[model samples]
Target: MVHGGEEALMRQYAIGDEIGRGRFGTVRRCISNATGEALALKTTPKAPLRDPLDLALAEQEPKLHLLASSPPCSPHLVALHAAFDDADAVHLVVDLCAGGDLFTLLSARGGRLPEREAAGLAAQLASALAACHRRGVAHRDVKPDNLLFDAATGALKLADFGSAEWFGDGRRMSGLVGTPYYVAPEVVAGREYGEKVDVWSAGVVLYVMLSGTVPFYGATVPEIFEAVLRGNLRFPPRAFAGVSPEAKDLMRRMLCKDVSRRLSAEQVLRHPWIASCGSDAVAG
Candidate 1:
């Protein structure tokens, strides 16, 4: 049932249960009244923009999402169906990714995915990042929780643009945001960084998918930060026994501690592992 007095405002959408929540808002499952199509509605409260930084993030989120979903849409990105704002909040209606997020899926699968299966998913994600980078966007946060899937097609979709930013050639970004496990060493060190950070995060995702373990781990936040800064990436023999050497090579390149030596998204897409896997590997 719709909230009181919301029915008239949301006449076109039959709002359902809350599906997700973040620092700024909540996402509810909704249905279009005319076509009865499923959609996810993200609502952010305008009242929380008291802080200048919070307001900036609030405004940037929609812009970034729109840019990624614009003409020449990348198949691996979540589509923004529509957007509108009421007096108290902003609402974003996007594709309903019924297959849920990759983290949940990975957990259910006993914490790891087969090498071939992981390769297919990583290829699609790399392609998506390549598209975004070409358009001057850097998805600062790329992790399992941000990856969603289409139930019908089994296609992977990159979601969440809250931390994304646009950068021009030669420009660098300075920030200490992003999930601890996936953040690049440069970011952990508070140094200026560029799009390469996303590649590093993608590499972390691949490592986790193939090994069911994080490349860097610690019992506390400070310890995790130390581990990340130390940049010791290990592939336990048992965990990587079945993973191919080609895949490991790609991971090494992507997860390089020295950002200068890291592979770009385009390079990642062209790596021997992805190339040999073929297009079938990316199929839903």
Candidate 2:
């Protein structure tokens, strides 16, 4: 919205189709009549009661999105422009990426993506994560659904920082948050962890991109937790054919069970597999 808090702006926008919905809100693409720029409007209802933890996270998310957007980086993150809280709902205006998300692409392409394409995507995503980590913003969620790809430029972006946390004073977190399948073992084991958790999730994402399946699978959360704790990734040699050893090594470093031993996002950006993508091709 154009105005400040506690009231919705008078400006009218042509709202497009719904993009996504979660427990707190729904995101819809909109075209601002005043500016003619496409923006994603996320509306979170104000009245309904919710868990205290969730409410706190919801209130903090918009600010974090704003923080990530101010300086801007490659593998563009969705930028939050304005926010207003009314009796009905809290509205957020954000930059729009019309190419949808990685989940949609994977669904359309029969699951697994090609190595070259996935590597390029990984490079872009790594650059974005490096930026976020450098700023001390931890993107707790890093699944396919949270990754948006710009088809026009083949640029992949990290989106939906709803679960993100800012690292003030180098504080580590202890909570069983984030999606079960994508959450790291340290988090699942109820151990204190930091940004490395995101790297682990990114490794799981890379595995999915290359093989069309998650590295760990089970019928229930506990089973998945056990599998993650054991760190048994079933990457048969034939599974990801022609995938460079450097890439696999990097992935192994990311998925390391010990959070302290895991590679930082910046280190991952410099990995041979990522470097092989080339400077011009990879995001800055």
Among all candidates shown, the one with the greatest TM-score: 2
Q: Residue 30 in candidate 1 has what lDDT?
A: 90
* lDDT of model 2 at position 99: 87
lDDT of 2 by residue, 1-284 (tens): 23555333435567788988876679888888788887888877766636766666667777777677666554556667777765567677877777878888988998878777777777777777887877888889888888886657767779887788887588887777788788999888888889888899989988888878888888998998888888986578767777667767888998898767788888887888777753345654
202-235 per-residue lDDT for model 1 (tens digits): 9999999999999999899888889989988889
TM-score of each: 0.91, 0.91
Off by over 4 Å in 1: 1-12, 46-51
| Model 2 clashing residue pairs (backbone) | none
Relative to the true structure, candidate 2 reaches a TM of 0.91
